[model samples]
Target chain A: MMATKKRTVEVELSTSGIDSQGRPTRVPLVVDEQGRPVPMEPTLTLEPDMKDEHMLINIGPQHPATHGVLRLVLELDGETVVRCVPHIGYLHCGFEKIGEYRQYNQIIPWTDREDYLNSIGNNVAFALGAERLFGIEITERCKVLRVIAMELSRIISHLVWAGTTSIDIGAFTPFLWMFQERENVYNLLEGWVGARLTTTATRVGGMAADIPAGWTDGLSNFLRTFPRTLDEVDRILTRNAIWVGRTVGLGVMTAEEATNHGLSGAMIRASGVDYDVRKDFPYLDYETYDFDVPVGTAGDVYDRYLVRLEEMRQSVRILEQALARLPDGPVNIDDPRVILPPKSKAMSGIESMIHHFKLVMEGPRPPVGECYVAVESPKGEKGYYMVSDGTSKPVRWRIRPPSFVNLSAIPRMVEGHLLADVIAINASIDIVMGEIDR
Target chain B: MTNFSAAPVGSRAPRDVVPASPRDVPRLGGPQNPSADALREQFGDVVPRVDVCWGETTVLIDATRVLDVVRWLHDDEGQSYDYLVDITAVEYRDMERPIEMVWHLRSLPYRRFLRLKAEMQKDQPLVVSSIWPVYKGADWLERECWDMFGIRFEGHPDLRRILMWEDYKEGFPLRKDFPLRGRFSRSEQLSQALAANPEARYSMEELSIVDAFQDLPADVRERLAGGEQPGE
Candidate 1:
């Protein structure tokens, strides 16, 4: 087939406003009577004039301000954010899927990694859920030990949040001061669990081991010195004019908004919601402890910072009370089905040896049921929903990660605020990527 | 005596009730609260079963009217569950209706907690309207349920995957049938792509920058782009 000649059409270009150099002629800047430069109107356009077009900008998958691999696509008009779409799962490791195949006690290490900064709290939350499922009431000593460990972890997690938030907002000195205290807390943890960061410190029924000799002495010393250091950092950042200016009126969430969004811990308390799991649910004998839950009126970054600082103080109070009431008993439960027997007994008797072997190999078989338990973790309510199937492993192990839920409110918090305020708002949330993407 | 009936699976014998400690703040609401009774009366047929397990009340409702029940619980003046604590799904592959969706709702004012669950067919895992309109926190949670268990929230505004990537096409990883080891391996996928495009510029082995240009001259990048072997 012969090819027909290509049809061509002559298209006229709009050159009326063109200069001799073939560039669009510059429109003179419009000015008010006072001589301030005003924006010029468009001379040529195909589409109708919209006042402001939104430009989409991506922040973090690697950004320092995000505190993790959280990627947020921000739609901006000028410098104010119009909308924010968060893209997560860059750090997803299928923790829940992996828990399905692992035995009950074997999943403690997984919880440790969920919130690396607050591993002990995560461990305690998971253990409490499992114990509730098995209907095993722990001993008084175990309860006191768990309370101490959880409060210590809460202090450490909050210190990290304080340091990171201060650093994000351009105050570097508080970070160093707070990290010094964090290092001390980590040393205290290392003494208890033999690990620093990911301390799988607690078991299903109790602790991995009882607190060693002199552990409380060091904790007491920390309790004394930590408050002074916190007060110093508080003086440095809480009243600094720049800190107040950047955070005071930014990202204010009301009580109703916070409750509807399911925020927990300081996120909700800062919004004036007086709900604390330690106080309300009263597990682990928290009902006996004498400490106040701090609530704030204005739910802004500055308010969150204040609430977290007050919570650390309250944690110190709980630590002091728990230390005073430290009981003398077996840390682990007395049930053979839950805790492994002593090596001496196992070696002396065949039945005990078989029990030990089965306990170590197959793990504890919880009853077929489900239970949901939540604790006041450093970030928020770190909850675990475990469904047992009369087997060694859980049929479904669901982690209600507080960071995942709290981070969902970032878009709502950052809308209509300046782009720079995103850092302050995100820092206020203080999310851990491991938990959010787990 | 092998007494299996002595202690049931999920039951605990009543212990001595500890008196309220001196430091115990009186609960905001009374223990004789009638929220459970109110729920039972309001949604009579919708909630077929109400179980008081381990001192926590859980209402088992039909999947068709889950939205109605939750809305009633949320909007009802006496039993307002203002806070939506958690939402998740559990898979029981052997059961007739294999998927169970669990929701934990808490009322901040009353200091009360309630768990609501609805069962869905394993093959058709569809739930009624999304609770995002009522609770904004359900946005990511509903997406997570859909990602992990393939449970569809019918009226969700954005129903895409949250924890998994957009291009992920494997079976839902949280389902019982999904293998412990994932269905597709990243290394295998890379190798297959390299095998399919052998004549293309880069192979799987050379995808890394350090491996692709180790100890090569500055001009080697240009030479390799011209289809010339760098080492030669």
Candidate 2:
């Protein structure tokens, strides 16, 4: 049986009145070096043999656009894709299998590596999962801190995104601007977390420690300048003839297609959906903060790009709001089961020291229930599913890594687009293979 | 790697405190049970029994009926479970049943999700969920199910080793019964061979048993202890 054909979600302009001869006088679909759709010459025409029989091209496992280790088998007829099959598990280290063996705290560092670019987000997702498992509550101060850290993470992740995506799409100015902001973010985060990429900084109930002094001022300065730099990128790319020509209507997805595919984050927002986990399902005090969910009319590579660019601005707005309300109380949950006693107390009291040693040697166990806790990361809804058997180690732990699901939609987005546009569409989606393959 | 070891693979199975079947577990007629008449009423003759837990209703169906139920869950009824959320497995080894295949379905329409399970024996298990048809997302999840657990998705377009390199005959490593490691038994076989022949395959010193005890060829006979290559 033949499968139903879906609509094109790639961004393109509405048709203009044709002049005289009726040869698609305005802009039409572009074709590339291999005759696939190109931004300049978008068309879906098949070769003679291709017209009769389809061709299947496996796009990744090594292709640059895949982000990391993902493989896509694209069955095409000339440039129009007939079917796209994704082969995953190339990076499945059996993380779920491994989680069953280690203590609850041992799993925090591992989450950081899943989405290396958004380690704070990954850490919080796990942190929230354990918090839910034990029914631990966070103080108002920690809630504000979470908002600040998560917002900073979102900005940093998107900054890397803007730079790396521009790097991919043959643009260099925006690349420099985005990276300068990223370097500032890196300095601020490192000052607070000690390590950068795999910072196991966020413990279960609260942060690892209090924020270093003056870090808030540094973050505010970064947030204040970020919008101007973003404006610079916006002025350069949003209206530039070539930039618009290349991205404005390329690799579009619509609301229906995106919803059906379970697309989320800026990718879905780019296609005009109004779903933001932070807003729709507010956790970690997001509802208290004021921010907007950026939406786009077209779900094209360009639309996704604009959505993310706008999202970074909104994230900055949130950071500024959170910074104003930054609290000064204890950050970590004070539960004896989840946290170690104070060193002074441990030194004076035998019970306190024994409890401290036990907490360090063997982590606290969660109850025998399964819970899947999700948080909105810069990329999308990053969630962790934990299964406990009344033990310190989890019975099973599975990551609903957004990259894994998001990468599945690549072939559909790039199939008819020009090969060069493939890079742009991939960058707009913002996938990290470590998370994808995990 | 393991901080704590569990019962051996061959040891007694883990037991579940079997609760009384939810009034919904419809009984069929024939010892070779035919379709449950009551079940056919709520759902069609083919519609499987739907069970509810935590407000989420899981529709248990035969693997052959996967396409129909999945299609109904997504299109025919607008559940728009158009999104294939996740696919994972469960091992029921210590129980009377040893294996269960789980498919987690999510519907963007209601923002609700459901879990489906196909209980099967360890020997031969079969299920037909043509992923390319339902949520194109299931294509990879289905491949992974086959790759790690060796579960077969009957209509899967492409099924092959996803993680382990080819030529690996070891059983699905995730199966509770599969050995955590397989090296120990391999050494026992080598030891028995050495007992039979001190020079098992051949001594490093000998070209051949004194059959044709002629001076051994340089290639076959041992040279120096550690001096190294002939090129030297």
Candidate 3:
């Protein structure tokens, strides 16, 4: 009725909601009966400092140094860190929850996805956790094969860091050279485990399948040339003044501070802690191997960079030894309680078929006890704490992801440095988001 | 005296236990003698009793004695589980005492380790002296236990959900009682069903694809209508 003086006004506030399937559904500002905030894709809001005591810089959940979905709320003063609050779980895949429902063996696929960069290491860690808790010994052939795979994984992980870090720090040439080697390792893994980045081949008590023939000899050739390739790259960067300037003394942390921040693997070792799980908590024939744990002089980004580079050479050394000591034995444990009877046993025998069915549907139980097993992962010490209530599924299967812990040092490492240094620091730490947020 | 081989995951049956590589030297505690009795005697105030079973030693200590115990193990001046290889928790919700905190520790100098079990009532389950202070790696390990099983490490600098999203509070998913099937967002299941059956009819389409086009926004309607002759 009143067309006199009218003006159209629109207030837009977009929000998200879940559809019937939990898929994120968005709404344009829907209000409830009570007029409260409805849940949406998890978001963070900085509480405006009521006191105005300090300035805050939000560093991630998207920033490059975070390596993944990690968000760090850093309180800083003139390039120096006053406080750092690390918030995680952006990439939380509910892996442990997934493991709870899955049969012990069914979880191998998920483990590969957690530490996607080092599937071999993940497989080995999980396999060892199962074996230690169940007292099932892996066969010699399987152990050596696993060793070959894991050492290769360690090398691949370092190569990725080298490439990614080089790109992060303004050097593009090393990225290509390093990725060339990573691609070689990936192709070899695909042949061995049927997947490139995520190999779900390592099984409890043994591997999921036997090596696809000539793997040992094939990997040996790769390992032989790997050193020369690394050496060629090293000649350019290891002692390069520019490389040292960006890394050395940047993100400096002492052994005490590193340990305090829960640094491990190269992060702790680079700080002069001298800890390597392969040497500390031997797993899967590691006791018989020969290699050195390279230690860093400073706990700084440069030291971490050095530690990982040296560690790659050491992993190659271990690979050489594994090749020479390859042994022949059953790959999977013979026990029906753990490893399933071969298909040959199942097709004809009713009992074997039933056993297979039960194993698939119900799964085997671990003894009523607890075991914590830590193995050297490419990132650091990837440990699994498995506890059984004597049930088919584990009462608890927890993974101590090295990337998650190592990345915690980011705020400390980059507190006073330029934002650009964050990428350098992230590369130095070698944080793999899948593993970190797992 | 429990010697997990002081063997770690592999058991060589004596004859096969070859000398460890430098890489393997620190395997399970760097070759130091981490006997339960010796640990008990060393931290008489911390370790009340130690039991060696299955070649692995489990140490029993009063909840209050943990700090003193770890002080002895980590910085006891002689033994340093300096490298925190790993830290984890155990939930014995069914035990007579219903204990929940068990810390596995290793001393690199001696190349040995022991599992410390601190029994506490579930309602007020608490323990002191987490290995986090000594080993940087234990920070997340302790946090994981806290997140999954509701175990707490008193002195951890940052203790919160490490895996589950910050807003999640449905019950610890790792607990024995948490159902595997349920607790998923309804939308999650719906989407999964939809993904599996991509051809399933949508509500608008069920109204008739021709009629559904009328419900589209003017812009989207224009784009789709452009795909065909209206009369056809």
Q: Enumerate clash totals for all models, in the order shown.
A: 0, 22, 25
**Per-residue error at B25 for model 1, in Å?**
21
Please identify which of the two predictions, 1 or 2, would achieve the higher TM-score against the true structure: 1
TM-score of 1: 0.82
Candidate closest to the true structure, highest DockQ: 1
lDDT of 3 by residue, A238-340 (tens): 7666676788787788877876666778887877776677766566667777777778776777777777777788788888888887777778878887778
Model 1, position A187, has a per-residue lDDT of 95
Candidate 3 wrongly placed segments (more than 4 Å): A1-55, B1-35, B42-49, B85-87, B92-99, B125-144, B151-171, B181-232
How close to the true structure is residue A18 of candidate 1, measured as C-alpha lDDT? 63
Q: Please give, for residues B1-232, the per-residue lDDT of candidate 1 as tens digits.
A: 1111111111112224422311222212224335768877887887787765555677788888877888888998888899999989988746664688899998866667898888787657365568888899999999998898888888889998999876577868898888887776879867865767443543333233445344344444545667864343
Query: For model 1, how does the per-residue alpha-carbon lDDT over A303-364 read when each residue is reduced to its tens digit?
Result: 88888888888899999999999999899998888888888999999988988999999999
Scanning candidate 2 chain B in windows of ten residues, the lowest lDDT window is B1-10
**lDDT per residue as tens, model 3, B1-232:** 1111000112112333342422212112223235566676776766676654334567788887676676667776566655454555555436455555677666654556677777777667454566665566667777877776677678888887776644455777656566665467789867865766433432332225446456555655765567844432
Please state every model's RMSD to the true fold in angstroms: 14.1, 16.7, 15.3
The C-alpha TM-scores of every prediction are 0.82, 0.73, 0.76
- The numbered model that scores best in TM-score is 1
Taken in order, the candidates have interface RMSDs of 18.2, 21.0, 15.2
- Which prediction has more favorable TM-score, 2 or 3? 3
Docking class of 2: incorrect
Off by over 4 Å in 1: A1-51, B1-33, B93-97, B190-232
Model 1 clash pairs?
none
Model 2 lDDT per residue over A133-228, tens place: 765677778878877778888888888887888777778888888888888888888999888777787787787766899988888788778788
